[model samples]
Target: MINETELIEQLKRGDDTAFRTIVEQWQDMVYNTILGIVQNETEAEDLAQDVFIKVFEKIGTFKGDSKFSTWLYRIATTTALDHLRSRKRKKRSGFLQSLSGSGGEEKEQIPDFHHPGVSLDNKERAAVLFKAIDELPDNQKAAYTLHKLEGLSYRDVSEVLNTSVSAVESLMSRANQNLRKQLEEYYNKHYR
Candidate 1:
């Protein structure tokens, strides 16, 4: 296996094999990052492909300031957020069209996203936690997803978010509170 430095050097030289190797090595990481944010399997898959395309196209701009995985993860997170924003814009447009009596595209259903890395016995519990995560504000959700779901360190998440670690900590604290509230409400509503 080629070392990452050598592989990146080959990629910068436009070597197809090196590009393929990078894709194969990093695809799951990219996919899971997008999946954690977007919470839709099909959209995550599509956006993951888009992330790699951007990585390939921008390979020459890599400065080696951070690890390749860090750079790649930043791209994946940004791509996923972009996808979510575009979908929201479309949904608003579709709603406006319907208000004007013009039939619009049907709303897409978001499934209960199951992380492939989650243990089989924990799937249902993880699903509930993810549903609460989906309710978090964008910043809090991104922080939590990167730190808790993706297992990135707080410093790494701060770097990806372009924020201080303290800010990441605050976001995580709020996220934890919100998640607890949501879970409590859910349990009270269903289990009462």
Candidate 2:
């Protein structure tokens, strides 16, 4: 295995092979981080590619103040959140257009999303869980996704989010409470 320092140095020097190696080493991690946030395979895949492209373009800005993975996670999280915001904006605009009768487009229906990381037996439950996760505030959602779905430690999540560990802990606590409320509502409606 190439030393991470050497690989990064080569990447900084614009070595194509080093860039390829870095992508190969971190692609799955990047993809999974994005997938957990976006909760859609195609968008996650596309966002993962965008993350790498940003990495290549912005590698010079990496000051080595934090672990490379921390920086990469920050990039992934930001990119995914930006895409979500853009989607929300487009949806809102579409809604307004329909209200004004300028848009002949029918209402768009998002299908139930299933994360591939979920097992077959738990797919339905996982889908419900992800929907609740989607309702969390952005900070809580990012903290929860990093710490729970991506298996990152609270401290690691804090670094990626550029916040204190205590903030991450608080976010996780709020996220859990919100998710419980959302899930309970879902179950009450369907199973009660």
Error of 1 at 20 (Å): 1.0
Give me the displacement of residue 9 in model 2, in angstroms: 0.6
- Model 1 worst lDDT window (10 residues): 104-113
Error of 2 at 70 (Å): 0.3
Model 1 residue pairs with clashes: none
lDDT of each: 0.88, 0.92
The residue ranges of model 1 lying beyond 4 angstroms of the native Cα positions read: 104-109
Q: Which 10-residue window in model 2 sums to the lowest lDDT?
A: 103-112
Q: Tens digits of per-residue lDDT for model 2 on 58-133?
A: 9999989999999999999999999999988988998999999997479787778898888999999898898899
User: lDDT of candidate 1 vs native?
Assistant: 0.88
RMSD of each: 2.0, 1.1
- Best TM-score goes to which candidate? 2
